[model samples]
Target: MITKITKFITPALLTLCFAISLNSCKDKPKKESTIVEEKVVYPSDIIPFMDEFKILCGDGKSYNDLVDVKHDNFFYVENDGTTDWVVYKSPNSGVTSRTSSNTRTELGQKKEWLPDTGGKLTGTLKVMHVSTSGDARVAASYAVVVGQIHGTEGHENEPLKIFYKKFPGHTKGSVYWNYEINTEGDNSKRWDYSTAVWGYDMSVIGDTPTSYPEEPKDGITLGEEFSYEINVYKGIMYLTFKSEGHETKTFTKSLIKTDFGKSKELPEQIKTLYASIGRDGSERENAYAGELQNFKQGAYNQTNGKDPEENMVWHTGSETYDGDINKQYKKGCYTEVWFKEATVGAGTPPEE
Candidate 1:
């Protein structure tokens, strides 16, 4: 009986040893799990932002014509400031939703903005847009390059932001616009929303700004840019820009009179009406010879510096504008014009 008891005790001791060994292994910290979680941003989602970047550069649309689609990354917030997530291209890359990642504007911060990470490239647009305008009026100077975006990395075009469209009071190095463009897989459609838009020049009613102090007679005008709403319900696509010394143009994209199809001329009344706005060569005196006039007639540059007609876009002054009257008829500077019906372009106009 004693020997049998000993044999059983021996087996028990061995089992105990195995149990501890397994526990030791289990207690070992996992190395892989300790790694930081980075978001996986997709190229497709980021690429459309290129379109926003391009539109401001020289595309034939107003700044309002800018739209975006965003792609959100998987994020996990910890008690500490550290945020972890798999890096993936987000939806609406070009559309600014007031995310710290998209635009860093303190004017109107957006909901669900991950402040820690978003304060990067995507953040510049929002913050810069408002601040530049404000600074322009107070200081009566053009805001210098606050900085560049997406520089020399995944998106090479990031550096091109240095040339973003400039407003009247805002100069070339001073111009800025933040867009968190959320794209809907289809290139044809886009949504613009989550705006904390602000401007420096809070001018009076009916007062529009003109050119920048340093507006070069030689270069182009990146006049008032536009921002559209994501929902069709919101008309007057928010048209924001420096209104010279007056109220920073916090106007809406009023395309109510704008027809969907291209017009024979800038239309009849539109021409004389804008002239009353006090725009010089920036806006066409006759609607027939306006911004579209150059393109329709093949006047813009095609080969070398020559227009399709061999006329340089600069020589025409039909493109850019500056200063307090920036909101005036600056050519190439995009704004929403109301049309009776929708006949052309990618998206349908909002119902009147």
Candidate 2:
């Protein structure tokens, strides 16, 4: 979603980037359903720890405050002055809410927000509605999974920054905008998305996908068909804002549990899989390894090691031995999670 959607932006707001596991049967349905082990510090505990970093957008003085996560909150607040903040949560992604009051509006991208592509703004705009004098009649919009969000309303609200290399020959209110966050922190999750098709110019550089059904003749453009990758289980939650909720897509990955208790040593291995990060270059791995502590996309695994971000100090806790991405990869995904962790006290940089 991040890659496919963000192409609607100025090329500075987008990011794209990965899988798997297997296991056995045996009605071992206990582990996946439970947040059974380890102490999950409530939002109250998570807020102060998260305060060390400057906010890129929105205002949340504390964790319990309006931290509408993933931009998934479906609060039906009219675009009036009272629609100050969005605070909501999703089971698969975790908790996050942010303030959208007139006081918290940010006009442009943060200086720190940079795309890996030659210092360009990320994503694109699929639609735009601006006044002839230069002001946004409507704020920028975005979606996270099933959720939709509008930019902090204010200013000349110019349709100025709106752009997309995709969706050419479009005039007036025919374009859309997209914003995407990445797994700057977690490793356990991934999103199915693309950065091709639908855009005006289908000349997307780098490894263009050949397997897509609507394979554009030139390179891939950004629109309904462009795709990319995203590991959303932590790190950054990319916001793909389309024009007036135009880019609302969904990814329903119904995960099944596998049996990892079959082996003696696998228990320890599974523990690492759960408590640490996943995928070698996975964002979660980087955050768990404490390498991504400075980035905005939060990390998910906060156990069994030096605190990543959140000041989530490690503490011994009961482990949940469900078939993690590891077992899912082995059996279903046909991939392997080569787990790694820091030595007792040796500092290390993550290597893919």
Candidate 3:
């Protein structure tokens, strides 16, 4: 009897020990996750050039390290079902660069290049919105610069400013580019030479402050996809504009010398467009040949809240609500651009 009882007690003890071992294992911390964490997207992920550039946002926010970071309204990443895009947005009135009246949530290439040495910058984007409130007579009204090559040393003028402009009730807008003159005497005498990329150039504006011209048949509509290449190779700037359902345009400019230095060189568009504004200054004899210049891409707000009567060409009489960002965005007093792709690097030699 004693042997049988010992056997049964031993079996019962073994069962109890097994039960305790299972309970201890259940209490142990988990080493592997059962649910995977979702991957986070960033603006830098959308625009890979951020590694070589720094961003200045409209709210005076400057960002150098943006690998996985983003600002809310000024600089952020947006996803439209399939593809991700980096959005550069700015209010009509806000803190801006010291030399500019416009506010920009734009990227500035940390690398600088000379006109002779050359560089290449490309952008594929669409303009979503531009400020609606502004004096129609103002040249800059209802316009926003999307990309530019800005000089840094001399007058800090821009050699190229790609723009998209539309009137208040227009069904389509104009896609144009301008070359700001590197002035000869003072920087105040500087002006830009407008060139039409697709539709009308910057010169096509309302006859009066409120009257608008007939819409262009080939004008770019808001949210239309377009691409531009500012390729300065061997001191020659080659521009290529591409879009679906529209003609592809290519242009070449000699950056090593001036093409519009004399008053006679000014295009008829410039004379007529800038007639009342008094901006007939000639470009430097050499233009932006050797100036330290850099690439800037994004929404550079051309419209502002300043009194238009003061400087009708630039001073836009737009509604700003005194630089109130929330109000500006709500009322569409802002410029918004979405860049799905961009590249900045050395310019390659054109094919022989």
Candidate 4:
């Protein structure tokens, strides 16, 4: 009886020890997980001049303080493996400025001044993309305005519009500038005169809505780097364009005086380009003189969904996806520009 009792007791003791060991292992502490987060970069980090201007995004969002601000798709910073760039992007159709119909993800200078007490702006940038779907016959299609001088008074007309336009199925595009006349009477009759910096002017367009003109021989390709300087000193505007393997072009214009004051001064290009729209009005004699003006830079999308038949000059009939920015970007129906460097300041006299 005693031997049987000892065997049973030994077995129970072994079971009890096993249960205690399992509970002890379960109570042991676990090692905590370590997660690392990436640091976010802002547009202001790439361009320190964000404090000097305000931004209007393509989605109608406006920001007065850009020091640590960034809009997701419209304004942001991108890295090209080697360097970081401040990107300005806009869709073909979106909320626009009250004074214009086009969309823009652009910066507006905070300070305004007259032509006599002038200002200056410089930028080194590259256009990454323009709207791919549009009417080829329309001058504004597949184009974007990268920089401009906009008046704050009178008709609030644009004095200068530097453009980069590329037709579909073409690898090369034109770099040009347009000067909009401050109409003498009705602002609705104002027109822009385009001048080429590298290739064809804005007047060079396709004959049909789909047909494209010949690809420019001496034109700028997408992603190509270029620099521009707009210096308005003592009521005179001086423009300089520079790029590698391209001609360094320079121009001078008077902001105080009108070059298109007389009807006879209108070029043949204007007559032909504007004849369809009946825009035959001349500019005011004083032009933008005494009017408060400001500088603007970024992607001002000229392409739109408006029918070309309605307004042959300004309309593009591009695909908008009903103002869906994501769809527009995925389908290449947007304008994108990258600026590596830019500066804004009081204008100084050019080297004599």
Highest-lDDT candidate: 4
Candidate 4 ranges with C-alpha deviation above 4 Å: 1-34
Q: Per-residue CA lDDT of candidate 2, range 297-332, in tens?
A: 211111111122321111211121231323322322
Q: In candidate 3, where is summed lDDT lowest over 10 consecutive residues?
A: 261-270
> Candidate 1 vs. truth: CA RMSD?
18.2
TM-score of each: 0.24, 0.18, 0.88, 0.90
Residue 265 in model 1: shift from native, Å?
22
List residue ranges in candidate 2 displaced over 4 A. Answer: 1-194, 200-229, 232-290, 293-352
Per model, state how many residue pairs clash. Answer: 86, 78, 0, 0
Tell me the tens digit of each residue's lDDT in model 1 across 105-154. Answer: 01111111111112112211111221122112222112222222221211
Clashing pairs in 3: none
Look at candidate 1 and tell me the lDDT of residue 89: 14
Q: Please report, in order, the local distance difference test score of every candidate based on alpha carbons.
A: 0.23, 0.21, 0.87, 0.93
Ranked by lDDT, top first: 4, 3, 1, 2
- Backbone steric clashes in candidate 4, count: 0
Total clashing pairs in model 2: 78
| TM-score of predicted structure 4 | 0.90
